[model samples]
Target chain A: MSHAIVAPVVLPALVAAFVVMAARFDLVLQRTLSIAGTLTLLGLALHLFLLAGDGVPRPYLLGAWPAPFGIVLVLDRLTATMLVLAQVLAIAVLLYAVGGWDRQGRHFHALFQFQLMGVNGAFLTGDIFNLFVFFEVLLIASYGLFLHGAGAARLVAGFKYVTVNLVASTLFLFAVGTIYAVTGTLNMADLAVKSAQLGPEQSGLLRTGVALLLLVFSVKAALVPLHLWLPGTYGVACAPVAALFAIMTKVGAYAILRVHLLVFGGDDLPTAGLAEPWLVPAAIATLLLGTLGLLAARTVQRLAAFSVIASMGTLLLALAMPGPAATAATLYYLLHSTVAAAALFLLADLLAERRGAVRDGIVAAPGFPQLDLLAGGFLLGAVATTGLPPLSGFLGKVWILEVVRAHPAWPWLWTALLVTSLLGLLAFARAGSLLFWKPAALPAPVDPQPQARPVLPLVATGGLLALPVLLALFAGPIGRALEASAAQLHDRRGYVEAVLGPGRSAAMVER
Target chain B: MELLFASGVGVLTAVGVYLCLRARTFPVVLGLSFLSYAVNLFLFASGRLVVARPPIVGPAAPGYTDPLPQALVLTAIVISFGMTALVVVLALRGFLEAGTDHVDGREPDREGRS
Candidate 1:
């Protein structure tokens, strides 16, 4: 299974090519191949997770090339955890899409397969420049998917999305060039060693590079000042695309943790604690904006979009501090928020169809079919999203609160956390009563058309909504796994030696 | 030489940012291209400038430029090229669909234009 490290990246890439080249003529064939490839990827991801469970960082050198001289894909607990989470989200989103979304857009399945290939590659790559390549891979596929079943609104929004990401990519190259100039290598582990040992003159340039890198990642994470792109982009996307996009923001958070924490994190490094000053205040602002925007949102889709920003706010807040407790909480909250946000988006789409003219707007509509089932799903998703009790959101919030109690700005953090949770609860409750309760109390309007809602998409939404409950039930084991992942993440020396080998022989690769 | 190269990058970036802030998609697309050009130049020079040296590793070579930046620059150029093509097509689509070239897809008022 030594090759399992590469399977998550390689398998989907090959599958994407075959889907385009062989199955291009038939939709049925494309769906079958795409779904089968995803399920197999799930199995490979799980096997790799078990492999990484021993707390060892396994670096797979491509083409038998030595470290620092060739590209390496490192499989560790952190990468494996992300892979499993991504695949699970992909399956649910795919199921929901096939219920009819893929039919609306040409080449959805092919683009989807390529998207998975890129996400998996991004998670596995050990070289910084390779990560840029994977980011472009995923972003390009996403641009196509973002405009799937294109409309005027979507095309306009897609323009801005593409432009924003293009700018971010340019900044990414600028940062990488600066770092390469100083460190002379783009291998992350080697950079960690070289950057830490740099003299003061080089330290200034390195910090500037690190700061620019932070900007690019934050744009992806949707942190404040750079988060203007999220609401517009996610709100207008097709539901399943938005659902899959739940992990996209998490990719940004993952890069921050991987690069900022492990590569240039320690006291000896020039860039140590660089993200700390910016993360806390900006995260809180992001959370505040999300809460206020929730009440102001006209469409439930926009509401869900803002909720993503808020959830990232909480995740990034935990990310501000790097300890076993905080990092573990960050990881768990990351999982819960992604599943919960996806559930909200799917539920919004379902409601959109039933409401007809209102089409996902918060205004009340007459009773629609399966109101009770849909209502229940909304309530569960809301509970999870608003951090209410008896679900994973509340659990994650409690963990975060405990860990952040030691921060210098604990009072501001607590007030922001508590106030936002209350307001979010109120927003959801008001939206629910208007959409579900008021409609139920009123008579069912005489309808021009009342189509029987498909059962498959409902089942998919219900399955995603149920994950929060499952996460709560299995909190102990999942919590332990994340704790171990956090420990592995913080132990920089272990990661460095794992990638570069003992005696640090990467210098020999130099000309 | 350093001052010239640094100022060149700075000026390209300044122009890029200025055009990017314009209210039309055409300017934004052009700005993105300019920004990419600046970045490509910056990446090419990251290994430091050298003259009359081969990049290969051989005993006869008196000196060598860093070959890695060349590789990096090549990759950056290809990606940026593809990205520019995609964005231009997208901007064209937006203009066709919305029937306006404004970045926000709405025509500006006469008063605002003035």
Candidate 2:
């Protein structure tokens, strides 16, 4: 691991800290600084990605302390992948901000950059405590962005979003505290090492700690029972902010995948007893509820919000499935859902803006039929979500079924997933019908800025849709990578070895 | 000592959850604030409550409190404060615009109004 590689990860956060101090007249300078910071971070991520391709690992320790002592930053294939995806989305969203860039929203742009910094830091950080800090940074930025514009609706929804997250953050703290109390270390790698020595009772306590951590992440991911804040709040936010948040939910999913699957043991194979046995059923329920919400939704934005919830369910389902195949499916689904949800949300925002209001129903946009231009795109995305053939989503589902087919008890889980995927298709079909097939009376005084629409949103939508298509086309290599990562995830020894090196602690390697 | 603190947190959590389930936005926000306090304390206590010995480094600190949890709790405190302010502002805005603060809002009186 290269020692100097941590500078890029730290620079954006430094810029963000500096940005908070600038005077009003330095607004232009602040935006410039923020943009430059993201660009620099993007460059570093790309550079490290290239390095990973060459089979080099990069680890940077903060404050000159060694790993398991001071904070550490890790740069590997997974971190590189998430970094690239996040930076691309961050840059696209920033460009999209060019449309309504004004002094009133300058703070928003600054905070957006800060949010990106936090996201990148979280992905790169090698320590658990650092992850909490980064999460706080991102959440604070999100609160500002959620309330950036508009009037009462945005504020009301924003309040709910903020309140729920505040509670989640607190729970997150408790989880971290509990873990530290048990393991006597805050470094994730160190915790994994120390935790191995614990007895069954101690392990159970750690499981509770992990469950508490999941509680916060579930709220962030908008799992079924906890998703009430999403629809109304996300439905009314302006287009760019909504698009930005479309990707933010994935952060929670990412946490579940990273912390539970990586930092903690027992989530791996051969330890089905690791987490709760209820996760699968809960995931299936979430999927059904989300799809149902979509079917019942009236407006485009609300439908998209519900779709986000359903996508979360699908990701969870992917996680709950058996073996390497299931892990592979989870990875593919994560990429697919993030892209599709983002594109659909951005498109919904455009449609809403075209209409005077989101309440105007589907008829507001007279060019509803013209959306057929995106029919092929939506169909491809829908097929992936529905687990239909030739799409990555299908490949994922097939893999999961292959792994779990022999287990008689798991049949019901499979059935639930199949049913929900079908329901998802039905929901999308309804959206298609409303947006394309059915028509209603146009509202008075249509938008004047129809033809010369903003170029950034178009680019944003195009970029989001393009990713999954590329993923499908190159599914072979991507699937292989995911399977490999999942195998690494399942076998605790490899992760422990990588983080702690061999022969460091014989008792730690007792597993 | 730890048990008492944990129990207090539990009570705070229960109260917060009950308040959150209420119809009006103000009580919900208050409930959330209380819940956050409970959560913050819970997180702090999760490290198992040692006094006058925070996890920061010093020469005589053989049994220093875990620094990582404290750092995490600090961030949580700051973020929760921001969240509370934002939620309060948002609730005020909604109250002004919709003429009510209940989440459901009488189902918008859709029946006879139109």
Candidate 3:
């Protein structure tokens, strides 16, 4: 609502659109525009972080219209956090892309900014219909990024990515339609208020609509059965591009989190009452399959993609757990997993370049000490992936365990978590052996590719690696903040009040 | 009227699913496109089909159809169009490079095996 909240989202959007129409020039100007825009956005994120302590849910009304009639953006604690994350990742990827600068440099940077604009906009927007709009924008930009400067492999994979997303978008539309027909509004806050008013008679249709909505997100989030597109496509995409897309899955997870917190109210949704629920089972299956794929996979990129699936399972486990701690744990794991996945993808890209090969399978490309850099990053990331200690990942698991410990259904969930985590650890350990400890005698004579000068990617990779560890150090404050976010999210009425204004619930119900 | 529309959707979904399970990439794409149509129509129907009342809200239209669903569905239509274009291009590229659009990575075997 305040100037601080609006600036980060608005500035990048303006710059992105401007660059799209700007005169084509040398690679330097294009890179400058992107780097400048991202730097501005990052500055805004830090400023908003400082202002978040002011304790107001900042609202920005686009085009000067009221809440229900117009699109409004909210800068809450969660929204600001996601904004900063998006900017941080965007900057890293842009900097990394500089190493590969060619004719495609301008278009790549411009599209990347547009992608961030869509992401930050989606995070902040107050209405459901607007969320769909932002999602479409993000997807369109992703299509461009996915196929940028790759061979036929990327083209095929990009097609699958677009098709799957289109199906999900259609589902999103239908869910919105059904919800509006029942509730007469599309504002998320309004939906929350109106959904609560459905009497016992109308609960069936309402539940059905919510179920349909979750199905849409399930495909987007790459839940086990629906995740076929991710590994193939992400494995095929260029490294910096794949690293950028590492944030895409998080967008879907964030959507699921928002829906649970806002529309489903964390207590009254269709899946709320059932113990030994479907998501828990689905999540366990996902974790097992992902870890298995990690162990079995020969390619660096596919291994990282499967690792993402495993992390999603952890987040879902948190969701399946009962009460507030589950939500808090989901937040913690989300941050940890996203940072780790991005770093791994970046490292994979670096390895691909350094070894002078781009094959998906790990062929022996005479080892370099630089390989150790990737190996170490991969190990730390893998440790986080398995929820090992001395990292943010472990702290998140402990938080979830503390909450789920006393529940009557604790044993099954705990066993699932513990076993799947061990499987993850084993899978990564196998990958490390295959990658790093191959006999030193087999070193083939080096015929490296014309060395492309790379500086920014290394810096970006190092930054991403440092982030989770740094956050781990500040876990107490961050955890307290996450707990605050969880409490506010659980208090559904506070959200509705923030968006729909006070006392509008009673008035809407009388209709 | 609603039942007829619902049946149409069901039929579309059934055909799409069947086609998608086929061996060729073209058929799979067609199947996906068919399924996308069904999905979009189904979503539009979720707001409950109302004849003749478009979702336009103004002073004269106090009892207008729900504008929210219309806006959302409109956006979906444009996005689906983009995705379809992308899919077509991909299929073309696949056919060009690999000479066939089969779902499985390999060509059919010589011993009457797929």
Candidate 4:
């Protein structure tokens, strides 16, 4: 019942509204307020993380209403970890945007804050209905952010992103309807209990519902076949917005891990491990698709987009197997991938800005400014992104490989992981050489536009690059923390009891 | 009554999916609207079909429909309305900016030949 449980959701909402109403006319005021709010959110998230690390689920029943009847927000270690990761990324992206990207369109600050609100709410909500609500919130804000620059390419890609997500949202509703019709509940913990006791006649319907839900989440996570919209959308989105979106796919992955491990994972449930059978194969295909995409990508931004997909594939590959060790590895990889992808997006923007008309293309062009510094930054990002040694990406992939070594499909999983890494390495190497090493074959431009690399954007990109390094430096403690969170996620009874009183959970199960 | 409701949902979904696969933005937007309508109806039906029943809790009521799905459907309706509006604006912007209504922002023939 601690009030801090709601701060992550409420604070961002308030800041968003305030920015929209009060600071819309004054760019300086908007920037100041947005930065302050994000920093505050990061601090709050860190506090929540420390609290949640104690392994006790803190459930805040809004309006003093009880669980299963009223809305509740649960703050656990997993939620806190995601919140901190998302907030930290948000601050870095916002700082980069303030370097001039925010002024490209109206209401960028407000939309960014609202996006944070939606993301934080999604992580904290204990009800499926609320999850849908938060998903809509984030989607609406993202639509605005996606079209911020108002370019033809952005508008086109934004349209596709919107249509795809709308369809997925409808599917989500259908799944929720089916679950409600069968179980008469939307609270996740309550459904966990009700789902375990479903009669044979209702099992089929419930299974269909769960499968539909998984499909919806997979689309959001950009699983292959449903991931056609991602590269286009992320590739065309403004740099800072795209950087913020690096966490969006992880939201989908988190939902899959949370719901699958908690609700339908019971031994007696009819639909136990429903996602397991197809998860690994889909993840493998997604990995292959991403690697192929990396090889085929003609632009740095597109390469980064494909790398995001490949990393999601890697995380989900480990997560598909049901065990604490694999889940822990997935969590660690999740953090590494999110940070690395964001840094790559920012770096792509840096490269694009410096290349003048070439603008992030992998082809040779006249260098504009800041060549060595930006090249160095790109090298760091590329190394981390391709899972090179001495970085957290390599550590995360290695950990995942070691943890999943005992699985029946370990051979296929390991092969996919290693091969994709190699492909990614080769792809990045080709891009780096073409972008940084290959001298432009053209004469110096007669009318060169003055280009000055902004300190804020470079600092922002550098800050994000430092994150994976920090993760590598402190791998011992962070890995253990992730393992603990994964253990808590797998302990379904503990979660149900924490949300609902232990006595009520037992009684419900008995009934 | 259940047959009528169920068939309505199925038909709407069918048409929505069909239109959603169209190449143009206008039809796709319309398709999304249709899909949202179908989803809203499906969500409403999840609470079951009941006559002469109030959703509110009362001591003297003979029967009551489930209120949760109604609440959920209402929220879904509002969200979908907002989403539809945004998509309409985005589609309009896309057409105006790209000078084509094709979803891929290019001529269909050009894409096919390429």
Q: Which numbered prediction scores highest in lDDT against the true structure?
A: 1
Instruction: After superposing candidate 2 on the true structure, give the runs of residues whose Cα lies further than 4 Å from its correct spot.
Output: A1-8, A14-39, A54-57, A101-104, A267-272, A355-360, A363-365, A368-391, A403-410, A438-451, A509-511, B1-11, B39-73, B103-114
lDDT of 4 by residue, A140-222 (tens): 99999998978998998899999999999999999999999999999998998998778999999999999999999999899
- Give all candidates' CA lDDT scores: 0.92, 0.69, 0.74, 0.90
What is candidate 2's lDDT per residue for A1-511, written digit by digit as tens?
Answer: 4643675556766786787766335766776887787787788778876765543335576776767777777766667777777887777676666555434455766677778877877777877778888887787777778778657666666666776777677677778777776777877667766776676767667777778888778888887677777887778776667777876788887777767766664433222245435556667778888888877878767777787888788777667555656766777777777766766766676555554444425433454423555555556555655667776667666666666564456778678768777877887776666565444444434444546666666666677767766777898888777666566556555555555666544544322
Q: Please estimate how well model 4 matches the true structure, expressed as its whole-model Cα lDDT.
A: 0.90
Superposed on the true chain A, the predicted chain A of model 2 yields a TM-score of: 0.88
Cα error, residue A80 of model 1, in Å, equals: 0.3
TM match of model 4 to true structure: 0.97
Tell me how far the alpha carbon of residue B108 in candidate 1 is from the true structure, in angstroms, after superposition: 1.9
The two-chain DockQ for each candidate, comma-separated, is 0.92, 0.52, 0.54, 0.95
What lDDT does model 3 reach?
0.74
What would the TM-scores of all predictions be?
A: 0.98, 0.86, 0.91, 0.97
The pairs that clash in candidate 3 are A1-A58, A1-A59, A174-B43
Candidate 2: residue A436 Cα off by (Å): 2.8
Per residue, candidate 4 scores C-alpha lDDT tens digits across B27-51 of 9999998999999999999989998
Clashing pairs in 4: none
How much does candidate 1 score in TM-score? 0.98
DockQ of 1: 0.92
In candidate 4 the C-alpha lDDT for residue A241 amounts to 95
Q: Could you give the DockQ of candidate 4?
A: 0.95
Q: Which ten residues in a row have the lowest lDDT in candidate 1 chain A?
A: A502-511
Q: Cα RMSD for candidate 1?
A: 2.4
